[model samples]
Target: MDVKQVSVADKARRWIFSVHFCTPIIIIISPRLQILILAFLAASVSACKMNRCYNESELSEAVERKLRSHYHQPPDPLPAADPDSPSSCPVELYQYLAPHEENRRSLSPWRYVLRSMKDHFPSTYSEAECLCSGCILIQDVPGKGRVPVENFSYTSVPIIQSRVFLRRDLCGDGGKYRLTPVSQDVAVGCTCARPMST
Candidate 1:
């Protein structure tokens, strides 16, 4: 087996010379052209370095930076509801400190574990969930008999869709990991309203 080593300067030169400016003809290139080529090479090398995402260590550093930023800043306050239209069933919400905190426990028997699994990429995923999922007002209504229930209202929880950043591997792009948005459902709040049958 043969392994070839590539230096940064050699790679930069290869990238710069691969441009259309290089030709087989032995013509004297102008000083301006030489300057342009050098500038292009520097720009390409810098951009490549900036865009490189090689390993999990980089991901860890990025996630830590984002978490620091998230913790340092205060979260936005929830909007106040109008006094006239106050809801009887209020929803209590809490934020998760880690990614997929809701699904950390495995309930199924056929759970497959990956030895190399790591933390999720950082995202603007500060959405909350409802603490209660049962209807308070509907508890008085009898389940067996069709009692004439007056002023009976059902509390419905409102669900919202939020995007979270997940790591993805690009097969053709040297197996680099990139962050992509994945849709997740979040329960924002609950509202009390009259049922359709009422």
Candidate 2:
């Protein structure tokens, strides 16, 4: 195969451009796949650098940066069923940390993996659901360092339709509890990510 020399700038530009273009295709296919793609993109993008690894702490911080930029809010304290309920799902920033403190290999830039779970408590309860699959990735400008490139991913799991009967105690304990409200839709939004390289 014939090889053509490409400048670093040209290569970086091509990669960033390609990732941006492929995202819509991946998203169009399905949401679950989107999560995976998102993870792949960030990880791959991070790897593109000469030094392709950061520590868990660095990765975690990058995750925060990406999330904060995306949601326009802190990544922690992610939305819960009951915003005020103390028993709500703990605001876990990173569910799974890399085995090593530092990145041995390409880290999962999509480090914020919020798996689906039911938060059941006696007084208050909440839930976080995954809604989609696949993902996206972005690379930094060839030579910039001030911005600290950002990388992250959000995964959405399919929501199964089911009948949910909500009981409300208007009186008191053991008193009349109304189970009139029913729900057939489940909205699950999950995210996973790691960090970005400068």
Candidate 3:
């Protein structure tokens, strides 16, 4: 066999051995090539580690920051009722009742009643007053049952308005009361009569 051909065969044998041994036989045969391969492997390993390091919290925070930069305020919190109040109504109730004359037609009767009460009545009321008169307007219609507005209890009271608008009645039995009336935009106002202060 030619000497050059013998050299080529020897190189092929080494390459095959390297593959079986799980080593880079071709790169190891040349010092310059080995250095280039090592550099590429190091870069690829670093990239892989970097990609794996990112987590969901980091991604979420990044997205939130981007949103804040675009809009002057952070996203609104989920609607929730007052923590101190008796009612567990979600904050969505207030959002839905917000004064929007154009959207009045879209509101349901219950919503209208709530809006009217918030707009018309005083901020606070005693339990007796609310049960008898405060929530009296919320009658049990054909489909709807008696809408209770008594006490700060969750059972009777459907919604809790802002506490700042409410004051405890000292004259009578001494109970909490809300003064704000429901929104005028609603057609059917609350049926409850105004509480007369002693």
Candidate 4:
């Protein structure tokens, strides 16, 4: 063969060998790249799962603490009811009070107080036979007769006590109750005592 022809043929052979040799290396590396990508994806998924699990546990713990606190029995010797006071709301009621705009959709103060009393002090509540009276006004209504004030305050009285026995039992030492706001972000109160005023 001519020298030029021979040189051209040698060049083609080298090119073919280079391609043949490099092809397998590329092919081999592809699977390793895929494996690395898959490993990264799996790790990300596991991390997300772990985060969700942690959040759920935290939520459960918060709920459990709240339930325990709500149901726990109060310390002995309920506060004495002031005879002269026209309003006698449970201290717990203060916890329910917040900015009016935030609490517009919430349960009425009267309802919350009744529910708390029933749940926490069932025996005393049942025995006391408390009847939930509606809002009491300072003056008498034309047809509704004079509204007798049970609890009086500068703000609205959220609770009332009746002269007639609604429940015949005493509440015992479990009567002292306080309202605790759940979220610092939101203005809220429980049906217990007024913390701010006190």
Best by TM-score: 1
Scored by lDDT, model 3 comes in at 0.31
Model 2 ranges with Cα > 4 A deviation: 1-123, 129-136, 144-163, 169-175, 184-186, 191-198
Model 3, range 1-198, lDDT digits (tens) per residue? Answer: 111112453454222123335544432344456578799999999665433322334544533443354323322222322334453222234334446431221222122212112321232222110212123123455665654223221222223332222111222323322122122221222222334446
In model 3, which regions exceed 4 Å deviation?
1-17, 20-28, 58-198
TM-score of each: 0.33, 0.22, 0.18, 0.16
Best by lDDT: 1
Clashes of each: 0, 33, 33, 26
Alpha-carbon deviation at 100 in model 2, angstroms: 13
Clash count, predicted structure 3: 33
Q: What is the lDDT of candidate 4?
A: 0.32
3 or 4: which has the higher lDDT?
4
- lDDT per residue (tens digit) for residues 79-127 in model 1: 4233234232221111212344332111100111111223344333333
**TM-score quality measure for candidate 2:** 0.22
What's the true lDDT of residue 149 in model 1? 23
lDDT of 1 at 51: 49
